[model samples]
Target: MAKADNIFNIRGRLGDFIFCQRNGKTYVKRYSGGFTKAATQNHPNIKVGQERFAQVSRYVKSLKQQLQPYLWRQKDGTFHNQLMALFLQIAKNETEKTFNELIHELDSYSSLSNKSLNKNSKIDPSTLLYDAKTNKLNLGIIPYELAVKYKDMYLEVATGWYGVDGEDILLSKPNIQYIKLDKQTKNEDVIVDITPAEESQTQLPFVALAVVYTDDKGSESPHLVHTVMACFVKMRNI
Candidate 1:
């Protein structure tokens, strides 16, 4: 089937995660069996941060004596990565330990974000089109005001080989380029659309959009209907 030029033709509800067509391609879809690793790898940031907590549990297994060589008692007295295995043994629950308490243990030994990394931000960024050939997102059409309003916002588009989710994935160029989001597509950020760096586009599976603030907060609105339509920049071979 020929891909529809408008994102409105490919429709779904707010929570519905579906695929849409554009030009002659589709979003990097999971059902299609392509870019699966990339999509899964680009998991929600919350999942990536959980690893910091999991380590505390593993450290609880080994004995202090066994860890003495690498987990030495430092002069600073504060906990270290090598010592964590030994120190965490003091915990009453070796296996049942929760991330909440483990988080504090980590904070005492290292820096932790006082505020949630992203409390106000949406869990998933708005979806868009990722052009595998160009390594760019075809953020189809969006409100001119939105493009102008959130020009400084970002498209933390992931690029390069997919890794163990986003935790190990290399981030694309920080701030994607933006141009006018209009019908003409002249490639300028006027009062129409936003364009990402032409050279940055990739065959990555999915993307997360955000209107980040000075405080690191973000928002996502990756789709729309009819005229002022907005499609996320995702990639797929089919």
Candidate 2:
């Protein structure tokens, strides 16, 4: 007679059984059918002539590696293993949902903001958030002042127009300013005429704000090839 292969048996519905290999823990679902017939039918077949037997074996191996740290404890106490498994599942689900929400918010904001700008503008939300993530900016969400403060960090003029400095241009608060593009030379120039939009009480002298050059393209020499007109400054205060 052929010797029987060691088979691990799990009671109750398969779906209700939350298996955590990292902790060698198995949980039975209190609600629902415990296991779905569809899940059993669709389960991967690792060996022929084995129904749930193959699944159990494969699951055990996977759990062994995942539960290496808690293997000993799990083997010693079933209750402890179950509790740990449930906690891990809950934590993982929450983390996944949080990250998904952040990405969705960023995408929605970028789309709305960009749509308000000119058609040729390229605003990379991920790149914008990279620096903010390290400092108080946190997850790439740019506050008005912070955005204005870091305006130079995100916007780059098209290459070739050097000597045209943009430090003097004050990004107007609460409104979109149209950037007039001058196509007279190899490098383009951005002109911001704040005279029409200036407040009567303002005392600061009007300054010319132009995009000169930056290290965005890994070139030591300025390449005046790309020009962005719809760029807006993020202000901290109104």
**Best-performing candidate as measured by TM-score:** 1
Model 2 per-residue lDDT tens digits across residues 38-84: 77666655222253333334433443343332111122233334333
Instruction: Report model 2's TM-score to 2 decimal places.
Output: 0.17
Candidate 2: stretches off by over 4 Å: 1-25, 31-208, 211-221, 225-238
Number of clashing pairs per prediction, in order: 27, 21
For model 1 the TM-score comes to: 0.26
**Each model's lDDT:** 0.33, 0.27
List candidate 1 stretches off by more than 4 Å: 1-119, 122-127, 143-169, 180-233
Which lDDT value does model 2 have at 9? Answer: 38
* Per-residue lDDT of candidate 1, residues 5-113 (tens digit): 4445544322434555555555433332345676666776544445544555444333223223211211233224434543344332333454334323322222211
Worst 10 residues of 1 by lDDT: 223-232
